[model samples]
Target: MEKYTPLRTATLKPKSIYYPLHIRKLIKHKKKLFKEFKNSNFGLDEYIKVSKTIKHLINSYKSQKIKSIVSNTNRIYKYMKNISQKYSPIPCLENDNIFIFDDKTKCNLFASVFARSFSNLPTFDPPELTPCKFMHALDDIEFNLLDIDNILKNLPNNNCCAEDGISYTLLKACHSSITPFLSDIFRLSLDTGIIPQSRKVSYITPVFKKGDKNNAENYRPISITSTICRVLERIILNSLLIHLEENNIISQNQFGFLKKRSTTTQLIFTFSHWYKAVLESKNIDCAYIDLKHAFDSVPVRFLLYKLFNIGIRGKLLNWISSFLTDRTAKVKINNTFSNSFQIHSGVPKDPYWDPSYF
Candidate 1:
């Protein structure tokens, strides 16, 4: 992919992957020098040059592994995920009221806690919401074989597999055979408004955050849903987004997930807006609302009502409702697994495209 974005200014960084790997080579080489050479060893200087070359080689490997886009970026994500799991775990806390240590117990404890924390019932009636007046309903959409092929082509390889034990790499390799089946599946989902059973199951892995490890709240749940489900969702999400944009449903000031928008873009916009307004002799009030755990806090039922209230109608609404409901998760701790439980509220954010439900 082209590096179209402007380059970021350089900052201080580690010399290399030396803190963990190359330094060992240095020490090992020093030991070899003492044993193999007499006083005033000439090989030490040559070894230093070799060590510097090795450091650059290691840095090059790391740089290629951690590129900012998909495909390459997943390498770094997987590497860090593995390291983080080993470094920080949600072990059963001592004397914190819970007593568990084995993988099964730990998995169960994590699941139960995250479920309760994220799927809380609404305390009050939600505010009324409606679609933009300019919005037009998207009628029954059909996915052709080409569309399905494109979806498969775009899926990143080596991703965490879903319950079906299928990775994108496998799917991409066999897309010719799978295309016909997946196309039909996508069409049937559109026609009947139900996702495949395989798509609904998620494998939840708990990643440690901070605070008490015994308390499940200290860890974040990173779910892996069916790879194919993600592709299906991507198709739907794109259409919905086009409808929203054409109708001007999304506000200009909303920059959280929009394309070409980031923390830096938001910051620049804010300062630029205020400066421009000051020169124009206009006063403006700035207010910020930080919705904690916003994605998990969404009320699916109310959101569905609003979707239908807006121009969203017909099987499309039903399809979205199906996407939002009947999802289940099972927690995995090491080799042990827990019984699957229904996800009562909020969106399923395991799959990359799943978060676009909001």
Candidate 2:
């Protein structure tokens, strides 16, 4: 089979893959006209016309190409990278009546602001939960080769390195070779309820939010952890989800995080309910409340307690608790690296291609 198969090598294009011959010709013509008649109005006007036409054509082509490649992961990733916001170096940050000019100092300032936002105080008293009885015993979590393979294959192909200096693209390339080793490591971690210190280390990026850029409070932390850790977490998530679905722990009314359910589905369900009420001549009342710093403010102890009450007991619960605790992150502002600091609470808010996390 190897002898009979023909090998095809991909070649990089000098121009955009979406650019056509006519567009290239028009661009060349525009450049030529600009160089030949730098001081002439007619030449300038002709160049401007050609430039506008080229722009329109390029945008139209790109739009159509995007629609065609919507389901193509590689193409979609490229387009996303092209359209993503360019990184602007953060200037001096103002904190507590002082201006921080050093990159490391700026990072520490942002980190401190984020850490201070995480509170141990409970917003409201949560009812104590009793251990849930399940039909089948789920005492521990485990990952098989198939589970690891699937998770690795589904990972984003981004080359952004985590704190461990491993990129998702490299991980995907080595998945077939490393699946067995990963399966063993994940199983051992689950059984011992201990996570590696390296996996727990995260690089937190201070992304600018809408406000004065100098204020440390105007930025949010985006944590990027080890690629291997993410894979293991996916396996754990699968196990927890299976137990949740099988025991019917998740309510039907709750649409977030469930398969085939999204904000769009939630809106549809809500609007349908409202429409039915309108038909019956009933008034509809709706109130939308946004929780400030929801993810960052969640108390770790309370979260673990809630999970334990919901049947995530034994080693799995312990593993999750360990996963959350003792984690440390360093602020990454451009080329500057901050000193490592302990993360006291909240889940890591990693950026994803989907709208799930802002």
Best by lDDT: 2
Residue-level lDDT tens digits of model 2 in 1-358: 3599788866543343548889888888988988877766557777788889999999998888889989988889977877673657888988778988988888878777776765445657666776776666466865678878887887887777776778899889898999998888888888899887988888888888888988878887787888888787776776777887898877789887678897889999999999999999999999998978777766778877777766777888888889888878888887787877787767766432111211
List lDDT for all candidates, in order.
0.74, 0.77
lDDT of 1 by residue, 96-207 (tens): 6657778877777777877874586687776866535863687567787898888787767664677887888988888888999988878887898887777888889888
How close is every model to the real structure, measured as TM-score? 0.73, 0.77
Global lDDT of model 2: 0.77
What is the Cα-based TM-score of model 2? 0.77
Candidate 1 RMSD to the correct structure: 9.7
